[model samples]
Target: MKTLTSLLLPLFFFAASAASAAPTANSILGASDAIRNPGGAFSVTVTLTEFQAGKQVDASTLTSYSRTQSNGQFASLVQFVLPARDAGKLMLKNGNDMWFYDPLSKASVRLSPQQRLLGQASNGDVATVNLAKDYTAVLSGEEEVQNGERQLRKAHKLALTAANPDVTYASIEMWVDAENNRPIKARFFADSSRLLKTAYYRRYQPQLGAERPTETVIIDGLDPKSVTIMRFSDYAARSIPDTWMQRDFLPRFQPE
Candidate 1:
């Protein structure tokens, strides 16, 4: 979550307000037969590395939580270390809330929903995996793909965009399943020139009763040199109690 997408949107626009409807797990999967976990619970452990003008700079871990079928409803915790600055922690919520907890002061900055402004917050545009509710989704095409011995149907380029006319990313391209409508791969960009980032969903196995992406990869863009690659491990799909995600969890991780 310390990657570019996490900070990019919140720093740019305010979070999307509640009341708008979100997409169902069926629709978000991208194809009718696209694989998805039943009941929608998931978790992962990720590693992130920072780069400077392509040089390695820093690295850390990212913790994630989410419901399989819902959008803008996930949480991410990130760790950052630098040669000069003290290490820091960053937390983000789909409702457009982000918290910055510093190890040096043991203090945190909680952004109000009003002041917590960022453009890419709503549509999952700024993050690696988009789960926004307002974007227009399109099933562009299809292709035959084989993974090991399994021949899976991939929904080619299922694009989605915000309804607003003036936006940064013209479209988001994703490959999903034609049968299930679940996404296998997705890409985000600025206009047609710059490829900001891409996410790869793999190591998908059955958990509980459905299939889900246990492993994720996030590619960094041109600016903000420090991190080059970020990936998740210890992935799982299961029910998570709300009590485990309290706002005050920040204090528990404060360096003593």
Candidate 2:
């Protein structure tokens, strides 16, 4: 009886531990965000390319610097670097508010987070995202999604609703790899519950001491031929000044 009791006790404890370790929706989202934005301050260059009818239509590059605040929110500054005509334009995000600065006119205007930057990519898309902070996550279920090579990968699907009105999407459906917590795919939805675009995270590479997706492909739901690819590169840790987060300082701000 003593020998049987000892074996059963260990098995009972093991089952209890496994049940407690089960991940919640919010925990999964938070883990995924931490993997993407690992530190408090960082800078990366993103190249956005637009394709239509299987042909490259437009391309632009932007450098962005972001800092995470004590309140667990992020402030980012983006500067366009390519195509002379679009060069020098700046976008700044401090919390939920965002502003766009036109260097040529020296004017700063309020912008919506949903406003398109290039092709299917939105102004909000380029900014640093903390999903757990902005959205209320619910564990929808588990499913298999196709990877870049069209191979099925098991993932946990999450349905997210905006916690506040300031967010770009009214709701979002996301899939994270069950094994690594890497974001596999996402579908953005409008206020009317209409599907806006689908995004696929691919090309995992080492960046800032972590393996993360180096490329994000967004496909337009309205027009299947329209596609946007955002390539992330040149990631490095850097200090972002408080003044750069202000709209008034955008005109004088220069890319480092």
Candidate 3:
């Protein structure tokens, strides 16, 4: 017997096709090209531990980041990020699939339709799956937040729904800065009811001629006792090989 989640998979695929049907590249981009031009790979490390509403966590997550230029004449800018937890583990996306390889477990998980599920449902919404058919993003309003003593403007919120029929999401709202075209705060709910996941960004800096997120913290109710803090260090420009992007190459992804 198929589980409830798995049972819903086929239905979601069909629904994804219908919802995404006849949507051309120009239509997908809507009125802006920001999402289509996320730029090239970036080197990053993140530490995440406990972030309860009122609890202290003691763990750190160190990971690496990489992205590719998108397809077409402007496809290269449809960039992505690779955040690996260790020397032997990694998260990467080719064109249609997102691969998460855990060498310790000797298990490689691939999220198909690799463009939709980003920043969407389940696994605390931090698994970084790249399934393209899993989400539809709607730009919300805008707001201002006090970052230190300076007033910073942000995109306010975006309501992301699971594009797959089998998978369901409550709601995931991300606050991105309009001026900088970057994310500042993100929150996820379950069944659109409860606060299940939350992630926010702070401390931005220039690396590789781009303004990027430097400090990120993700805390989920699934394990409320822990908060994860990521510290991105040693930012530099260097090309990471294609073989390193392979699912089986996760165990050999060594940072230099």
Candidate 4:
């Protein structure tokens, strides 16, 4: 009886270990996403600073109000708040559709997620995104990668392919912290597998309900000298009305 018990205990332990080793790739991506943004409707202010060849070039600030939709994706209304020229301009993203509205011209134009906003920052970067809902993730491997702070972290690497045609990038290679599922870094790729930019997420701070990354450093894939720093602050949970996400409502929107 003792011999049999010992053998069963070892088998039980092995099974437990194996079960914990394999987590669904989508779940892993979701965990990382939670660390990037709160799961509920929220607003955040983003400051984008552009640099070229290690010299400061330009900067802008924007406020984003975002809510998760029934499809498990995010619908975002972004308002430009800085640089007198761009103030009152707005960007709306609902489902797979994106539009840019200019108050001066009263013109609403469609926007592609790939459209550059500032330096390495794109129209998609400022908006809150639920990547697990937009892409299919495959566990590529596990390795040690450098985080934004230049410290090495053990991470699970995922290769993500867009589930539909509307996503910002055709594919992405992401590294998430293996222990806590924090997003460490990612490389965005075009449809042709061309590297677009590499982003490192760091400066984590307690916000909303979780520890979220407060800063992102984006480096241009082609021009190693070009860099963009995106900083998030003033995060707060808010009730976003459905009307705020409408294209026509952009013209009548009032800032609070």
Best prediction by lDDT: 4
- Tell me each candidate's RMSD, in Å, in order: 15.7, 2.2, 14.4, 2.0
Candidate 2 residues lying further than 4 Å off, grouped into runs, are 1-15
lDDT of 1 by residue, 8-103 (tens): 878555534332343343365433223432334565555555456676655555555554324543444444433235345545443345556676
On TM-score, the stronger of 1 and 3 is 3
- Candidate 2 lDDT, tens digit per residue, 1-256? 5798897999999999998999999999998998777578899999999999789999999998999987897898998989889888999899989999998899999999999999999999999878899999999999999965466899999999999999999999999989889988999999999999999999988998889889999999899899999999999998788888998798789766
Measured by TM-score, the strongest candidate is 4
Positional deviation of residue 54's Cα in model 3 after best superposition, in angstroms: 6.0
As for candidate 4, its clashing pairs are none
Give candidate 1's whole-model lDDT: 0.49
- For each candidate in turn, the TM-score is 0.54, 0.93, 0.56, 0.94
Error of 1 at 49 (Å): 4.9
lDDT of 4 by residue, 1-256 (tens): 5898887999999999998878778889999998898987889999999999999999999999999888878899999989989998999999889999998899999999989999999998888898998999999999999999999999999999999988899999999999999999999999999999999999999999789899999999999899999999999998999889888898898856
Query: Against the unseen true structure, what C-alpha lDDT does each candidate score?
Result: 0.49, 0.91, 0.49, 0.93
Rank by TM-score, highest first. Answer: 4, 2, 3, 1
